[model samples]
Target: MTQPSREAIQTLVTQCLQEILNQRGTELSAPLTADTPMFGTGGLLDSIGIVTMIVDVEQTIAAEFNATVSLADDRAMSQRNSPYRSISALTDYILGQLSEGA
Candidate 1:
């Protein structure tokens, strides 16, 4: 199976962020970009917000990509650099998971 392109994954991730922002009735201080921080103290999301985003991302992947993945599993937690750290990292991680699932 072919891996999804980075642009495709980034688009999906951005859509997820927008959906979450809309639900929370909040706006980002800056626009979402590859360098945008996602989790942790200075990031756009709090703990609950991160959880919500992860769930939304996972569901989006399943619905859109026809693949089931667990984005917050033990493997993700064990990573030296978290997959959840930035938009770029998360997009790469999702692509990796999709490749693995394929």
Candidate 2:
């Protein structure tokens, strides 16, 4: 499969976040969007929550794109600006990884 577009990836991430929120019984005051913070202060997710989101996103990408990629692997952990900082950053990271597969 071809690399998914940024918007497509963002949509997937948003869906994943919503699923996580439902599973965790957490309620969001607003809709999930690209600017929604995923970690750090005022972020929606804690460390474990971030990990869950990474795994969820990875699985979804593997299933939807037919490509196995690690979202919480060493490369991502070592990044100066973490991809998990927000929906937009994660989407960009996923897009980069998918392009690498291409």
Best by lDDT: 2
> Which structure among the candidates has the greatest TM-score?
2
Candidate 1 residue-wise lDDT, 45-86, digit = tens: 888988998999999878887788899999998998888888
Clashing pairs in 1: none
**Candidate 2, which ten residues in sequence have the lowest lDDT sum?**
32-41
Please, what's the RMSD in Å of model 2?
1.1
Query: Which residue segments of model 2 deviate by more than 4 Å?
Result: none
lDDT of each: 0.86, 0.88
The C-alpha TM-scores of every prediction are 0.90, 0.92
> Residue 92 error for model 2, in Å?
0.2
